[model samples]
Target: MKKLFLITITLLTTLTINAQKVYSTDQSYKADVKVYVVDQEYQADLLVFKVNADYKAKGNEGKWFFTDAEYKAVKKIYFTDAAYKADLKVFFVDSEYKSGWKDKSKQHFMY
Candidate 1:
């Protein structure tokens, strides 16, 4: 029973660590990923949806929860004006179901 409990706890911890909890940083040097918001969805490498709760931010599937503090986030992102300066280019989607990687090549940036 103790082994089962430990396994369950470890699984939950791993899932939480892999969750898309992001913090927006003002300084680019402090950011883990430099992001650019594309005007059109076609121009984006990823389609992102902002979730209200952290628990809803699951996986690296682009469902992001903006954390109040940087310590609470899995990743820190800085928004760049130029697309060329960004590590990832994203487009905000209205629905969570629409959130996912448009370009699989740039998927590693979130991880």
Candidate 2:
């Protein structure tokens, strides 16, 4: 009886963990990120999210923020950005806005 009770609790915990994963933004491949002012508020949205969030959000919490609409946008990036070009890697800049882009030739990260 105790074993069965424990199993039930375990299953419920797993389900809870999986359900909260719809909100995250991260990707391994190249894609465009948008920068715009919404009602004077700055924001950025990834071109790839729904699938990427689901697959990669497992460990990406706090690393990125996401919304359901951005997830849907990922599915149509190609058609929406036909003439838009994207950078090589994904960049999540700080809240402060900057115009110049980083060079791929230089090491932007250091461990």
Give Cα distance to truth, residue 38, candidate 2, Å. 14
* Per-model TM against the reference: 0.93, 0.22
lDDT tens digits, residue span 1-111, model 1: 999999999999989878999999999999999999999999999999999999999998999999999999999999999999999999999998999999999888888
Q: What C-alpha lDDT values do all the predictions have?
A: 0.95, 0.32
Cα RMSD of predicted structure 1: 1.2
Candidate 2 lDDT over residue span 1-111, tens digit each: 999999999987664443323322344232233222222212222221222344443322213224365443222111123213332233344432232224323112200
- Candidate with top lDDT is 1
State residue 46's C-alpha deviation in candidate 1, in Å: 0.5
Residue clash pairs of candidate 2: none
Worst lDDT 10-window in candidate 2: 74-83
